[model samples]
Target: MACPLKNPLFFLLFMFLPFPTTAQTYRNISLGSSFNALQDNNSSLLSPSGEFAFGFREIAKDGFLLAIWFDKIPNQTIVWSANGDNLVPKGSKVELTIDGEFMLNGKRIRNTEFVGIGVAYASMLDTGNFVLANRNSSIVWESFSYPTDTILPSQTLNQNGILYARYTATNYSTGRFLLSLQPDGNLVLATTRFPQITPNYVYWSVKNPNIGFRFIFNESGFMYVTSKNESLLSTISSNTVSMQDFYQRATLEYDGVFRHYVYPKSTSSSAQRWPKDWSTSSSPFVPPNICTSFMESTGGGACGLNSFCTIEDQGPTCQCPNGYSFIDPEDERRGCKQNFAPQSCGETSKEETDVFQFQELNNANCWGGDYALFEGVPED
Candidate 1:
């Protein structure tokens, strides 16, 4: 026995009233107004084509580097990293704040402020460029402009650009090798042990004096220096357009080598596989030879202090000098130490008279220079 007015017109009006709606959520991607937390399993941003992804990549048990890499690759070929030298903890996150600030692990990354308006979204492009953009689609920041150790195709590296090598294959800490495009228009590969004490020794260089202000790695795997007007100045690679269909990267290797590697688009049991070396800057033009070119300031060769460096069919090899043994038997790079003392500090003349013969080692070098030569007898 309800009223007719409540059942008729009133009920019709209530049915037409708008209802509250929830905003759609995204997985493996974040909108401009949102954040991507690393604790979430799907925090990574995938490219539109799903070929690449941008996220915190694990370098060690608890160490993580915010990096961009090919998503389809088995081991994930990392191309660019945001914080290579200072890796964040595993649970750190990367977020593009609503006000347009890009924050990594709660710290705002400098120089990412967009002029005029704030960021509309941060996207991972299919070309492997991680970009911060405005609502109008204008780019505010991108990974291509700030490369770490590897440069992808179509990316331009300015004269001031530097590519630093990793400490080791498994360690993401900055290493001793550097590939820099100098202001003088020369691209050089150099190494240093201690920046304050040791001078940077040039291992390789492009001798062209008239080269341009920037270097460009084209999609076809050819790298060329370009003039200010975008004219070609010099070609760094001899590779043709044969690799147009493949993904290519030029890296400054940890062992102080500049090499070009190609990743095939497809993988098969019969296919050669991805990450095959396409070209390398060889000796005579580069180091002359990897083993002898690098003279360790403290040691004889490239190995380390108190180690003998020799060339083998495989590559350079290191060994302990006479009367010495490896500090770390598993790692030759740690160098060597004396296995026995020549004689006790305070011993009888008879004990001192115990004969000690010289054990000569070929190509032996030590830190601070070879053993000092004595022209006169000892004074006691």
Candidate 2:
């Protein structure tokens, strides 16, 4: 008897049998003239390599931000956000109308020159760029053009571009720090509390005469400032060859530190560690000690108003001056307040006089210059 497996009729029957297909590893969202509701259960646009995803990411309790992040990472590493300041409810949806109008939570989000020209679809590119395109596939708007706190490789930050720090690691709201390419061809990092009354508190700057009008972070973990003619004026690099293969992001952290972080492509949870490759070096020739040099007032510095910063092994630590106690014990950065009563302005009696004395604090320098200029005066 001939084996059934060797029979042509049996082979033909087996070849035609149906098999269960595996689900797709990633999902692609194609948008047209309708609203695409990106809920926790439903839809998202993944990059071709499945490395990055674009969708509504929960930032706070019932609050979500339209963001792009590393999908495979243990904790979502958001690179760019559309509405950092204006977070919408969890059930909010992003709609792209036929007229090229983009809406978030029923409000128009972006106004593009291609409005009324008919936008075909939106896609998330492998480079971490989320784009809206016209019928001819020309770009209308992209997330790379309006970055939040982080800058991915191959992205250019021009004179008009700004990287605004987030409030905290968990809070996606706008923070006190900002990094901008100035019109004078300088890259400056500034802190602002009230823009109406005070100017930006500039703590870090690249003020070279040959500084370029734009800055670019390349795939090899190198950042370059290039002129209009494409000549490289300055370059910042990590000089690590392994960094080129991983996903990298440079972020202006909320604490006013600009750092470069690298994520391995194939990392197990046991071996996973966010490796900081490079950073905009702080002044005073110490790593992250620049916070001590910045003026502390009602608006500026890492330790907040009336607090002095000191470098600790764990990082910067804020403390109050002598004779003063922290206004908020829970938050030392809120600064300190006088615990004793001030001397009366018009106390003339010698017995009832209040004397003022100075106490020296060791290893402490005032945030701003310590101005002690005084005209001589003798009281009876």
Candidate 3:
């Protein structure tokens, strides 16, 4: 009934956050004890909270440029792009000067203006957005606008215009993913090569105004949507859970899937209310494996769909479920094997030993197993 992601206490918590310290003199940027604002070199930097920082980075193969990152949170998510396409060359000299602009290895360039409105110095607000401000204290840029993979509540996914591009899968150099609002109000993700409408990949949607907006991602990697208005939360039909509300947050997952989630701010911590209660009408879809977690590779390195891999879990240990199975016992990237075995029911005897117990598990496909029930024994 209550909103979970919007922490009312966030305002007081950010007031005492540590500031960043660096050689470059900043007019408005604050430094923290444990951050490097600029990543490539230590000369420029920010703190850990993703509040404020600056540094040089190389984009593509040809350009080297000075960059800034929010150092306020543990994720240190980069919300802005100073020079997305334009980059400076690697190994070439450039230094961010004290007045606000960086000098190309001490050589002043024509474009010397460094400050923008709405951008702030590592100030975490009640909203999760970390804003960076200029000397006048106006937000020039924010972490919410140029999102890498995740989006927050109150953030609009525009359909009329091309809002985002897929940076490289791992390199972040810009891949082919496009996230935009559709003319019909549904949000979509498509490759530049494929422009046709595809239903399998539609990320999120907004059906009506009555549903209050809340999308949240959990620590376990599940995203959910919920209504913020208490009244609407009760009246909303069960089928609307899968329906994307007007206010929704989606992630352009690394595995090339656009997963939409409800954005709800916690009233206490940075956590959000999640595992969205799905709609009764709309069909719920399962998220891709990549969105669920990150896979670590051994000496063999980065495996593809064809490579075989195994995941160790508490329940089944290593066996894949009903719909899928193991490819190679030794490899994980070759992907999974499909189980064509048709599902059928076998008659059970009426004896006490034959009365089977029914069990429902979250995210589990319910493989083969035997069940036992007792009159008074407590179930775990």
Off by over 4 Å in 2: 1-29, 33-43, 110-116, 193-199, 241-244, 267-288, 293-300, 321-360, 367-380
Give TM-scores for every candidate, taking all chains together and pairing residue i with residue i. Answer: 0.73, 0.74, 0.38
**lDDT (Cα) of model 3:** 0.36
Off by over 4 Å in 3: 1-27, 30-40, 47-54, 58-80, 84-86, 91-136, 152-167, 194-250, 259-380
Which pairs clash inside model 2?
none
Residue 170, candidate 1: C-alpha displacement in angstroms: 1.1
Cα lDDT computed for each candidate against the true fold: 0.61, 0.61, 0.36
Report lDDT (Cα) of residue 145, candidate 2.
87
Worst 10 residues of 2 by lDDT: 6-15
lDDT of 1 by residue, 237-346 (tens): 75753343566678776656566766566444323433443323221123434555554333334555566655543335667766888787755655677888667536
Better of 2 and 3 by lDDT: 2
RMSD of each: 19.0, 16.9, 17.0
